[model samples]
Target: MTAALSPSESELRETLAQVLPAVRADLEDLVRIPSVYADPARAADVQRSAEAVARLLREAGFAQVDVVSEGGAPAVIAHHPAPPGAPTVLLYAHHDVQPTGDVTAWTSPPFEPTERGERLYARGAADDKAGIAAHLAAFRAHGGAPPVGVTVFVEGEEESGSPSLTRLLHTYRDRLAADAIVIADSANWDVGVPALTVSLRGLADCVVEVRTLGHAVHSGLWGGVAPDALTTLCRLLATLHHPDGSVAVAGLPQGEAADLDYPEERVRAESSLLDGVQQLGTGSVVSRLWNGPAIAVIGIDAPTVAASSNTLVPVARAKVSLRVPPGTDAHAALAALTEHLRSHVGWGAQVTVTGGETGQPCAIDASGPAYDAARSSFRDAWDGTEPVDMGMGGSIPFIAEFVDAFPDAAVLVTGVEDPDTRAHGVDEGLHLAEFERVCLAETLLLARLARG
Candidate 1:
């Protein structure tokens, strides 16, 4: 049997350009839904967002579209059967978003998509809503009749840690099977530089409680003799890192990151690092960001300064977030962290560690025919610029689920976000030009995959 003819780069580019305006319009409509699935009060909005995504999939020429769930937030699934000898591709994105934090802090309303310069700003504009739009753009570019089979999965609760993703994947495993999967929830190297995320840090979190005194007592009565729980908890947290700011955990595993030239100036600018503050860890900037263990005290449960009294609190709790490198077992890292907390708190303070969540890290072997096709597509889309193999410090635990479920499939993590996208932050936005290239790249990827 003969393979399908590949579409020329110019042809794909022209098609994507023609369809981009309507795609942007649809994205604007989607961003306005306020589908913050993490917020219990926004459950109705999440449902509405699912319905809207299903409609878009149907409009994109998917004859079989359904909003299905497994006791979790709604997830939209759509399928286009493969032609003879053609491989199937699964496209993944999420329709949900993080809550609009401090709406007054946003230059524009979080749900109202606003255009500024070359970017569009909204809560989910760049994170995953643009992901859904990019999929639609590829389909429209192919006139809703691509050469290969395609499955679109727009999840509705990724922002909420995807608590039900496992059950949902189990329930709908057969429907999601494909030759290659494109997870459009990562980020690019830069605004004009494309990237394929080859690795991601895993996640482990726990709440540590420290108890010094059995009950609140007068600080003046036993100031130097007895330690307060809050102070003890702070000291324990301080032990998780060294004076050089590197993780001091005894047995957590680490990996080597790609040798990407991420300058300190760029990191400082992007992270908004305060003046004279030294960066943490002891490795290359990218290595520390992507291939090392990191621990941070995210939250502390204690008396507020405004409500404080001269009393030694009986108990204090803190939530710790840990990021482990790719290939490291998250549960083991969590265990190590738990052990460190229990053993390092001196003065015989009662230390109780409760593990919260664990997500396995992903390290892709980015070499295969499907990866070649994607690289070719990206290079063409970016005018001969090669796509970088990058690692994301953030964790997307569901990618490991996809790899486990479809062991034979080649998983590709792609994204529409640039450095300034500010995803999950106040001015979350998508660069329109880079987004166009992303759409074009996906369109070409379908054609190339079918041709082979």
Candidate 2:
């Protein structure tokens, strides 16, 4: 049973209101840095972002702040000891942001935070930079001294698939140890709704090349007699899905998702699905999106329409991405994709499949006292709105790494994003009002955990 908020809660609300302006300013400063670790040109910017985060933590009353690296992008670690008999909590976020896709498509500059209506638009505004800001807000709301122990670990390469995460985890295991770990890099249910991510789909990708001939030939001469690599590649890709759009790959397992009311209208509105475009798969919309495996052709190595000629291409390549559901192995999923590509090709086309990165899916058991405290805190912050349990179609493989390195810690996947955040897409944004609630929820969570 939940109890009434104490006087301290009210005090915290007042304190947060006072500190929020500075927090938003700091968040804007953070969003201004193009810290895309995946881009070689932005390496220096990534380092700068890490340094800025370290400085912020130090200013927020963390006496011990260190910028560390594991042969990759720099990550910040800060510590504030817990009060006697209180549990320590670890806060996790990432400073790295995805590369802005097309500058012309943005309503404003991608690096410049702009307020339109009730949201702030920028490249890292919601994806994760707000996560860093949220942590700072909570820390400052307590006057830089909360009841529980606090350790902040802001990663710098999450957008780069966390290439050095395993090494970082192994090297900093002692300093990062905590009773509860909050990974603030997910999406909430909606603008005013809150959610705790209970499961995450894993990721696997590969490049498949199809060769139909040794050299390009005139299309007129080989129009009907010989197949072009591009046509053959298209045919092979078509085999990856059935008429109903479910994955046709063999040996893939289907998992279960939360029985939430995700109607077709909501899905279409969120995804911007075109009118009359039928939905994919046969099961519930949430199940297809969050539980079953999904495959997409992200990119293709073919001549552009403007550069096209009447020549039959000898070879063509396409990069395929596969989303593996919870409880499935990413490597196994990649193997299935590779095997399907090789077996489905006709006309004796030579197909070469090259594997890319793979990350394990994660399923969190959100039970016990820590989860209860988190739920209560969220409820209180949202004025009695119950938080929902949801699954993420995207992958955060490092969550599994955290679970593996610290088996006893209760991992809480909170979010600052709503359906319209557009993380990793053009015009990414964060809801101004909802962000305040996120800060309050996290601030209250730390107190509730200390009491437990």
Candidate 3:
């Protein structure tokens, strides 16, 4: 790596290339640990991953590296001061991942990094561990520092709602100020395209419950008069969308987005969606994704047909997730959604809704220098593939917080994940070639930003 590297620029590329094995090794180690944020069994694993990130930053020439919070899973932060007049760039990634769901679905252990057909499979490997590795490699090859100032904000609770991120940002706004923030937690447009995430949708999560009776009763005696909470809840959920899949919720604000074709067939093919299911929603992909609202009934607590016999059930609960467009108020939207649910009663049953966090989304100004630098870097890194523009349906939430804190800072959302990369699912993987390319891209981006 050192031999191939002539100047600092080439040196960075060479170092990243040389360190690919080790980087992947580290990524594998990080992935093997189930750092599931919401689960009690994985809290310690999440904390350990945070400590590892902090250690990497410290060893890579960042003098000021420590966990910002006093208790719970720490928010890892590190400062790398640059030469005078250079603008600062804040780098952010998450150390935690969604749990290894349905272990039998994976060919290999979810934590063990295994290579098969150019993919490194593991939980969190694609979603974030690769992101962390790329950033660290870039920082390291800059000879323990970037020419421009850098402040790294790696989170420990992204898999969950990221409850601690906003607090940490508020607690350390001044120190975290930067001219641009790089969020490496999104997927690219596809396997070959280097995508610049221009926008992300806001989010709201809730638990919807229906309790019709004190307990279950014999269907033989109560079938005619008894109110079945589960059946009523299912009917209520059905009203959320029509047969065509468009949202049926009334009063939710929606606006047209700049057209992003997003072929329906392509989405279905890429996502491996069920065969016979029709595409839901209205208008284009960008519209349904970035501007309009979407509701997903993620989970339900009900007795299966096989398990249930002849009983009239009294309780039912379901998890609801909503993605709001940029500029939409999540709290207000939540109120509207819940109100809609309450109004549409199947049996005049009592309903309970437990609200979760409302995370706002962010949009980047692509004409800015930070973006220009990224475009060039990405083109070079991906063997001359034109840089692509896309928006994330999933929200990072911290981007909004970062913007509020650093009013003048530019925001960049580019990462190692891509449309082909299956994230948040079993047998998750990272493309090694793309990982190297992203590290190189960051190196070039940092160099350009430093000079400017």
In terms of lDDT, the poorest run of 10 residues in model 2 is 1-10
> Model 1 over residues 172-289: C-alpha lDDT tens digits?
9999989999999999999878999988899999999999998999999988999999999888899998899999998875566777898889999999999999999787888888
Off by over 4 Å in 1: 1-7
**Each model's lDDT:** 0.91, 0.94, 0.81
| Clashing pairs for predicted structure model 1, backbone only | none
Q: Per-residue lDDT of 1-452 in model 3, one digit per residue for the tens? A: 11122277676777767766766777777787778877988777777878888777787779799876734566788898868999988898888888888999999988888999978888888888888888888887677767899888888877777777667777888888888889898878777778898888888888889999899999899988988999889999998887878777776766776755688789898768898877777678777777778899999999997899788889999998888777777788788788878889677799988897688866666777788888888887777788878877778777777777777878888889876677888778888778888888888889989766
Q: Where is model 3 more than 4 Å wrong at Cα?
A: 1-11
The C-alpha local distance difference test score for the whole of candidate 3 amounts to: 0.81
lDDT of 1 at 384: 79
- Writing each residue's lDDT as its tens digit, candidate 2 over 269-346 gives 999999999998888777887888999999999998999999999999999999999988899999999999999998
**Tell me, what's the RMSD of every candidate?**
2.8, 1.5, 3.0
Q: If scored against the real structure, what TM-score would every candidate get?
A: 0.98, 0.98, 0.92
Query: What TM-score would candidate 2 get against the native?
Result: 0.98
Q: Which pairs in model 3 have colliding backbones?
A: 32-111, 188-418
